[model samples]
Target: MADQTFDIEYVANLARLSLSDEEKQQLGSQLGQILDYIDQLNEVDVEGVEATAHPFPLVNVMRDDVIEGSLPHNEAMQNAPKKLNGLFQVPKIVE
Candidate 1:
């Protein structure tokens, strides 16, 4: 079922691209092979299989959120590159 009816020039034009002769030929062959593989996949039997977002069972691996004492503002700002008026001073990001 590897019947190829690909048109590389049509795709290139649609994408507003200028493909060389060699690139066009290569892309056509590659795209045809991809389509043939997809056709092969379409013939698979999955009557009892359920659609899934992931292949394996997913579980949250995060630790439980716990309230803890925060670092004091003075201590937190101690290592800052720039500090002013008891707060960390960062370069303004927005104009």
Candidate 2:
């Protein structure tokens, strides 16, 4: 219904895309059809319909926290690539 010829070249330039003449023509037609579909949807009557955030109901299926066995410092550092003074020695990130 609306003016079908959208500026395909301008849109392509904005998006930093290089489109051939055929591609541009194809995209222009596709975009026009999409806009027409949206215009059609605007004619629908839904005065009392409630807006839904999600299609399905969401429930927090979380489990209660529980403590687990703790490992000793020596045992924890056993497989470490490098350790010094009871701590892992990682490469310095900040100057």
Clash pairs (backbone) in predicted model 1? none
TM-score, one value per model: 0.40, 0.41
Q: Which ten-residue region of model 2 has the weakest summed lDDT?
A: 37-46
* Model 2 TM-score (2 dp): 0.41
Best by lDDT: 2
lDDT, candidate 1, 36-73, per-residue tens: 87887668898998989878976887867998899988
Candidate RMSDs in Å, in order, are 10.4, 10.7
Off by over 4 Å in 1: 1-3, 44-95
Note the Cα lDDT for every prediction shown: 0.83, 0.88
Candidate 2 per-residue lDDT over residues 1-95, each given as its tens digit: 55599788898999999999999989899999989878986687878988788899678978769887799889999999889998999999999
